[model samples]
Target: MKAHRLLTVAVLVAATACGISPTDVQDRGNAPTTRIPPPSKTIYLLKDGRLVLEPADVDNDTVGSLLGALFDASTKPLGERDTALRGFTYIGIKDSLNPIQRDEVQLPRTSTLTVYIRGEGTLTDLGKAQIVCTAQQDAAFEQVRIVRENEDRPSRTEGRYTCGELK
Candidate 1:
């Protein structure tokens, strides 16, 4: 169980650090083979083994160690819910403008699942983002970007499709 937790952490680290995987150049379902609508919420993809948060790409906030670790597992099967938090972690805040965020709970072998939760309903300078997750495999990522929804905060995005934008 501890190892599983550790691996979960590893995935979170990988997500925030380098996105999710190498093949996901664009967001999932945005494939050339299968055409999908452009996502209103710009989420970071783990393509080519890297982390990316769009419409913008950068990490300028101070990530709390405990929060980072908590975020690492929040999308999985751990961490707090819509409570309230701040910092630089894959987990961001949700507000009235952008009240939704999603995270992927990676399950070995099986398909990935997405968890969707509402954010704090407001954006403060502290990066008090809303959006939490539940471990649900094979489910589609949410339809909210952590920041794009609110131009004020661009890094904020969600969806199980997100590897880890907390970067």
Candidate 2:
């Protein structure tokens, strides 16, 4: 009887992970009795000539494993936690990169890259836009700045991060 119960639980976990809904599970107790949401927008990643492809946000529970989820383990798609934490991004690399040039794969000393974003979004009263930045970098670091708008004391903040290339 104990072995049977363990098997049942294992099967339940596997079914859920495979995108099966609780309602779809038969021979189970209460059909799981839980719900999770999938992601909205799809994204593509390219770094160091490597391509990384990622599906949309995916179920809220799995958000932590998504490319954007690398920013936060407990973050929802575009949800604001500004009063709590600063966010970062994960770069996408879909496929392996091959070398096909006269140069023998020599890396540069210093290269600056600028990404362009063209889309509509919501703004906070403090005037900061929430965006998913997916890029590759050698190390992770954040800068803080305090800006006073309207004679109010400037508040400390995490600097904007760019994640798309190796430094």
Candidate 3:
């Protein structure tokens, strides 16, 4: 009985001697939650005459959809940055046949992404950079071709460009 009593006292003293003070439960607000982010694509915009890569929210990841988002004014540039793709409209992809003559032209492979646009005058180098970089965001596409559509026959090829060459 003496040994049992001494053991009980020792346990009590040891429990209280440990410098930990008991406190009430803490209410740290609600539990943490996790959510998946919306879909987004990388696009190139211009800042002070230089190319700046930016993320843009989009409903689809298609080249046309991505370019459409790039051209959208609502997708404002961050800070004092600007977009070279402004004032340019994206046209549908070129088909295998020439629209005028109905002659079969070489179809573009998956590695080549073509961007057709209808705009007045020529596009500046920065503007070309924006289109080329945005369209070639996927590594699957090795090159990007910009074709200018006009009322006349034989559309002008702006030139085939690679993101590496432009950047």
Question: What's the lDDT for all of these models?
Answer: 0.33, 0.33, 0.74
Can you tell me which runs of candidate 2 are displaced by over 4 Å?
1-28, 40-42, 46-61, 68-167
Per-residue accuracy of model 1 over 1-167 as CA lDDT, tens digit each: 99999999998887888754556446657446764533323232233333323221213222222224334433443122222333223433322222333465433333332222234455331132223221111133332234324335533334332223332
User: Predicted candidate 1: what Cα RMSD to the true structure?
Assistant: 25.5
What lDDT does candidate 1 reach at residue 77? 30
Cα lDDT tens digits for candidate 3, 1-167? 99999999999999989998889999999989996442347778877788887777677776677777777742454677787666677786532322232256655454567789877766888888888888777666677889988877677889989877887
Pairs in steric clash, model 2: 39-58, 51-93, 51-94, 52-93, 52-94, 91-135, 135-163, 135-164
TM-score of candidate 3 to 2 decimals: 0.61
- After aligning candidate 2 to the native by TM-score, how far in Å is the CA of 128 from where it should be? 14
Q: Which stretches of model 1 miss by more than 4 angstroms?
A: 1-33, 43-85, 91-129, 132-139, 142-167
Worst 10 residues of 1 by lDDT: 129-138
Worst 10 residues of 2 by lDDT: 139-148
Ranking by TM-score: 3, 2, 1
